[model samples]
Target: MPEALERTVYVVGPRWHHHAAHADYAVAASLACQLSAQVKKLNSPIEYRWLSRALVRRLLTQSKGEPNYSLGTLLTEIVVARHMWRRGGSLYHLLYGERDRTLARSLPRLFTRPVIATFHSPPARLAHKGIDRRRLRGLEAVLVVAASQRRYFEEQGVTRVFVTMHGVDTQFFHPAPAPAAGPPRCIVVGGHLRDFETLGHTIRLIRERVRGLRTVILGAPTRWQQSLYSAGGGSVEFRYGISDHQLLAAYQASSLALLPYQDATASNALLESMACGLPVVTSDVGGVPEYTGSDGAILCPPRDPEVMAQAAVRVLDDPAYARERRVRGRTRSLQFDFSVAARQLLDVYATVLGDAGMASG
Candidate 1:
């Protein structure tokens, strides 16, 4: 390690430029904060630093409309690499690689150490080709959020694979007393890549069967809102950007959380819902089961709206079952603490650094 003042690790992730605000990609931002804090508390040789997302955005503003538009990410990587090149004693950590898919390939040479990265979704390329290989290269390990992703990475022979489940701030998401007068309700959250088309069908199912149920859909984009406008005859509330406090209220007021994702590799909303003592009913695809475990949340067949709706209704209608689920949900959330994720992540850094040391020696 370099002198104490120079020892550091660099983290690159989504650009949440606001004053530490919680945006759609805030899950990674929060986890980054946790990791940084833990590293500081340990008083190790390395310090944690984040690449300036704002700097990247400002420098590449004209390229915002570029096709696939990864110029900002590319510039960020180059900037960070140059910075680390000058600093000479930092490890590169890609917090999802942001949009720079080729980050790993370039980072290792600059840092003189293997780069570590996490993936939120599968590789975009259907088949690995020229640039795809570099895009997937240079990582010491690729940490995934669930076993399903690990399986995919192993099958494809990617770098080292590890399961790192999503973490939640239990203290921030703890349960509130259920509103005494509100009708039985369920919450729908997540955005962009979610299965809103299927969620529309699920809402219809809920309307047909469950009486006096309120369905609050949070963070539904214009496309989703337009498609789901007539859904449930307006019983379904399509809420566009909501605050964290509002989201917590939605969770605490609900009987269950519904996520009809076409596919997933662990969900931030699922973890948050359970952390707030809300049971969940989501599609059983990808890493849904990994997050739900055996009993915390009910899992239904994907694309089957009726089954998903029925599961939510069952959790809501049966007081005894909901109570059991609440207990299980909170218990499950406890197991996914940030500390657990931090331990595993720090271990990966240690291993990578040790391997680099051995090779150098």
Candidate 2:
């Protein structure tokens, strides 16, 4: 029997920077780091290497204003691909596919190694940002956070498309020891694709119906603070740059997770909230229903403050219903643990490597 060639997979993506001390957050921003960590524990033949952060920063700075399809971006990708070629890797995975679409499609021609990419944006977001189908056809595989996004890639003629559900750190975000005794409070976290206008309106309506209803908005941009505060009818509290312990504490103390989104794929806020045993009421847009399903959350139409507010009030008024939602949400979150996602990703890596080897033979 011949000795098998060793396999190396290089992970390329933006640095997982968080203000909190803990690496775990509800958003998929930490996917590269979390996924890499899980892959390491499996003790498989595949070895993973991260592209140097200094190199990434240099490339990002060069392509600051125009990150996609620009002359600078093209040069950046070429530089990165050539660097990897010289460094030597059996395969390459681009964690943020949007940043390196051109590289992903062209790598196979320039080098014999297989390339795969994971895309986080929904179809509408992708369309708005602009993606070239021709540039993406070269990928060995495409991984998406939501099932709804699979069709876009398949339509573009990419043969292998997989839906890898976003994962959360369940142990860190676990529920409180017991419900806190105080006025009902709701938490809103993260600002990406969030409908702040509708959130302000919904909070106002929620306060009118439920007395002593406190709302906390975390990670909101400083520019929008005044408007949100005024719209929240002076019952809103804003916090920023807090550590992970504080964040987990906030989730545990809150009564419900009230999130309104213009569009979404997979939300860290929703998953983190559910894992913390906080009931969720969020918008029913792209991939939101797919993650929450019928029982996991109370879904409301986008930009409809009245409907959102009504749902919030209902959860606040009925203890039994709120408890039911909390139980269902935590149960649902177990399905998205980081370990599960790591196993699925490992399988994809093995299959891609096997196919690549057969092609060469």
Candidate 3:
């Protein structure tokens, strides 16, 4: 194949929302834009074309829905795969694996070109969602956010699985010039796969130990979460749908980030908090250690509120310890910068295409 042809790739995923007015941290989660920017920076021959949202909407209106899958998403995958089968490319990369199983199952009949996907869900969640080998039959590579996820895909016979780092915009989420003046504040962001019972208990415990403690919960929580975490609340504030600047301000203002997770692959909230120079007290489960390592953040066993509370209180009480963690976390976050992730992903593309020299220049 010609080098130009080999460098051409198509990316299919969720509709991207660009926040040009705000910092990168304010932008919603999606790699399509970041990947494009990095490829340009490398000055590589790679050409990426993302499917338009308008096309996706049109397809959704014309297609029937599938059980347990979004009608628009299912139709988009089928249509995109069919289009790629007719029109040749070096590879087809699905940005989200959960949305691509139908495409994977149908790819073998449509074409023989290599197809790769990135899977974000943890093993347990994937298994619960019925993501078996059959649904993932035609994928040439499965890129996961954590090494821990490799076993589940490998056990299901995915021979070419790779761990890809989840990237963060370090420039936008940098530490504050000076700590905010007020009572000690602990910020809890996001509600996905979070152990709210543990969080609630930990908050109660921390409040008793630390004087003038304030807890801020970010993101839109469910009724269950709101009711559970808000009960017997003392200085707990819940903020929903705030702008990116406000979100960044919350992280900068907080003394520490308290993230109690039931399970995780990679957490945006964890990464962003660390990038903002806030020390973390997170659960030691599924890829959390991989991101934080030994010294970057304090880790507690899952569902253990006492340990979680103790870690948070320690950060709040000890200035020297908090500074050490703050510096270490900021340094750790640089390794997972968007540029690094982009380079790694391009290497994955090269491997799948069997072009050893690709992206080397």
lDDT of 1 by residue, 1-361 (tens): 2112222445666433421133223344345446554222111121213447686567467555433446545556566666666754455667664345556666675466656677667433223222244456667777777777666566555757766666766777878765324687878887735788888888777877778878788877777675575776676777656677877777887777888877777677888888888878887888778878888788888888888878877877788888888889889988876656655666665565555563122
Q: Give the per-residue Cα lDDT of candidate 1 at 213.
A: 73
Q: What would the per-residue lDDT of candidate 3 be over residues 120-204, giving only the tens digit for each residue? A: 8899999987779887878888999899999999999998998878878888889999876689998988878988888889888
Ranking of predictions according to TM-score:
3, 2, 1
lDDT minimum window of 10 residues, candidate 3: 39-48
Candidate 2 residue pairs that clash: 26-268
Model 1 regions lying over 4 Å from their true place = 1-7, 14-67, 123-131, 358-361
**For each candidate, what is the lDDT?**
0.66, 0.75, 0.74
lDDT (0-100) at residue 74 of candidate 1? 56
lDDT of 1 at 254: 79
Better of 1 and 3 by TM-score: 3
**C-alpha lDDT of residue 140 in model 2:** 83
- Candidate 3 off by > 4 Å: 1-5, 15-68, 225-232, 355-361
